[model samples]
Target chain A: MDHHLILRVVTRLLVAPILLFGLYVQFHGDFGPGGGFQAGVIFAVALILYGIVFGLSRLRSIFPDRWVMRLLAFGLLLYAGVGVVSLIQGGNYLDYNVLLPSAKAGQHYGIIVIELGVGITVFGVMMAIYYGFAGRPPSIEDTDW
Target chain B: MTDLAVTLLLFFALVSTAIAIALLRSLFAVVMLSGVFSLLAALLFIAMDAVDVAFTEAAVGAGISSVLMLGTIALTARHEMKPKRWSATPLIIVGIIGAFLIYGTLDMPAFGDPNAPVQTYLNPDFIARTPKEIDVPNIVTAVLASYRGFDTMGEVAVVFVAGLGVTMLIGGSGGFLRRRYRETVLSRKDGQA
Candidate 1:
């Protein structure tokens, strides 16, 4: 195969592994060093490499800049909103115990929800960042490429 | 003996990788090699038994940062031609500092003895009682989202500020730029259709 084909093939092969690794880290973050932020970045890298090989425009056709932006905003809102809600629930700021009515369950639920939010936001932001750089001037088309 | 051997190997791997990163000329190569540095640092962290930190450093510093740098390169520049006048003085100074850091290692506690300064003074009371009091499995989590929660709050606020700043800097000017882009993208779609 030609060099371009070789590059394409290698990149394709790498994408799945990177994404799987990202997910592994994300869910396993509780006991280990992996967490939402780190996993999100890992997830973003796979998309970025995909964007690179398939051309920015082609990548945009699938993910789109607008949805990515909305997702980014949504993640941040989810995180902040959770913090405020926890505060209002009678726990201190970001106090997970107050997140739910119960104590331990609240803590567990709070961490899960918040981290998941962070992961979503981080993932979206990472992609938005990539989209900003990769598909700076995004189209309004929501079609599948 | 095995542990010492592992630590020493990690040290050498880290040093050699750092040196290679410094010596590399190409930007892409530099990014990739710096990733090697992150990976080596991760291994060193593991050797020291800081499993959580090792995982983070390996995943983010080595993985995400490398990819981000690569993307920035793609968006910006790729191959870097050698500078016309590369100086050796800065390199010498950096080398000396790095050597000093290595030299300073002589004073550091031996690896993972549990009686080491860090382990001993780790506020064993808190480490011991936190799980019972907080009911969280991850001690780090208890410390992060609860015990040191105010700090986390401050951090979240800072993050909010940064997000705010980015929005402003990127032209959140009453959403005019967004509207304009929407129109352009729509018009393009209509034209293409």
Candidate 2:
């Protein structure tokens, strides 16, 4: 009980900073020590921390199944949006210079946008996996409880 | 002095960890050791100047995968299951394969050699062509999203398939059986502690 108490306390305290760092990493990937994948992991880790201490019930409220599915779709949509934006601007699919008025800035913008997509999808996938495993079918043996 | 000592201590800690993993019987210990090994491997990668691979390993291996495994562990602990011994044959087979892999690494370039075949071949082309062809300053992104797009697609498919499989197998709500593991663990705690 004490161990769980410690875990709960630590998780709540640390989750905020982990999330902030993830955002920072996502935005600052092109210039710094982190990127989409790293940010995704950090973001996922924070949630995992919450799951570890509090159980799956807490996570359900924060990230319902429907919303998580949508987040996954949203990530892919972001990536596809970039591609569509490029197509409309007269370049090949996924070509990013079409993202902005200026070609060079568009490239950077495109990378960041794509990275955000990757991060969201990854975060969603991680949560979905947690949900799939942590949530399971009932059996006769479980009736004792 | 302090920096050198810290690296050396970390290396020593890693060696002891490896030994502990080799000797331990508990599955939780094994999982924890694997996380430690992955972390050590990440540090080794960083030391070798493989920042990209290091980042990937640290993120996936240490952060996400560890969390996933811990969740799995917690769920299983709720149920009372007999401790079955793991088969040694599989372990032996894996050991032989791992030995061969280590041997293959020997034939590769020496650690951090500037003239390593990998660095010489890939980095030069990446440095040159990224600016000219892709027009993306961050060459790794260009290489990941476009140049090696097929690989990324494969990874996405792998994730999709896994989630699909899990959803298929588990199906519907996780009510009692899911909580069983936690209950058993709590009972065990009450009994033992």
Candidate 3:
């Protein structure tokens, strides 16, 4: 993989743009088609591409397994925390209307907050799954295919 | 109409792809064809005006699942094993299930019917009130993140648990617990012996 000049070069060129598109999808989801789920998967795709071309060890160095586990838990916590905050604010659970001075503003803020949580959790989980699959000891070699 | 023609063509392609998948013996080719099937389904979704669902099917189904399958093949055999004998049991079961499903669909409302239960339910209110309530242009987003926030939260938690399960099963740390448990059991047996 390291000797494949074209693949390495193309991957290097594509990684940054893929990550940028994932962010665009994540933030623009409110106004458009994409949301946290799509964006999270897209973001994970970029990292997985790097792992496929550059090797899993390199991907692990960049994003350690420990952090992946933490982020996985963190995303769900953020989502539940938002609900708790709303509950404490004298509104029904997950009622974004009470989060701010205005109902619309509160809805806007709450949606963004929860969407971020979804994105983070999805991204972490996807990468973790990829690591689980690719990190195993191979019974068959690359040339076997 | 062009939409109808394209939709029909895509459905035809989907059926063929599914049959091909069933007939193919090579696991690698099956995985590739499944990716193609997902892409076709995504096109169908787009034609039906469901761009968000289309994006997800294309990304997760075509992109990630294909890669994951390839990784799985690398870990195992490339070709599927031949069955020992031909059997009608599976075919009969499938036919019975398919008949029941088709029978069930006979009572369902037609696509985009104004009086359909879905349209008559909360959809009208969501569409009518989302502008002032959520202030978002996308009603889907308003409904998913605002009106049904608890459901989305639950989905997120499900994803979290899935990740945890994968970590416990296949991630490197889980092996430590297995080794420790094995050691404890062996020591107890040794004491008994």
Q: Using lDDT as the measure, which candidate wins?
A: 3
Could you tell me how far off, in angstroms, the CA of residue B101 lies in candidate 2 after the best superposition? Answer: 2.7
Q: Any residue pairs clashing in model 1, and if so which?
A: none
What is residue B182's positional error in candidate 2, in angstroms?
24
Better candidate by lDDT, 1 or 2: 2
What's the TM for model 1?
A: 0.76
lDDT (Cα, tens digit) per residue for candidate 2, span B1-193: 8656766777888888888877776657677778988898888777666777787788889777776665566556533344487678978998999999999998998866889988798888877877765576567776776555445545654554555456545522433443575689878999998
User: Tens digit of lDDT per residue, candidate 3, span B32-139?
Assistant: 999999999999999989998999999999988998898899878899999999999999999999999999999999877899999999999999999978999889
DockQ of all predictions against the true structure, Cα-based: 0.28, 0.30, 0.68
- What does the lDDT come to for candidate 2? 0.71
TM-scores, chain B, all models: 0.75, 0.66, 0.88
**Model 1: per-residue Cα lDDT at residue A81:** 78
Candidates 2 and 3, the one with greater TM-score: 3
All candidates: interface RMSD = 5.8, 4.8, 1.9
What is candidate 2's lDDT per residue for A26-125, written digit by digit as tens?
7776665566667877788788677656766777777676666667667767777877888999987877766788776777777778778778877777
Query: Which digits, one per residue and each the tens of the lDDT, describe model 1 over residues B107-190?
Result: 888766777876778658668977676675667766665666556545544544444444444533224466787789988999
Choose the strongest candidate by DockQ. Answer: 3
Which parts of model 1 are misplaced by more than 4 Å? Answer: A1-24, A136-145, B85-88, B99-123, B153-193
Would you give me the overall lDDT of model 1? 0.69
lDDT per residue for candidate 1 within A69-111, as digits (tens), equals 5666676667667779987887666777776667777766666
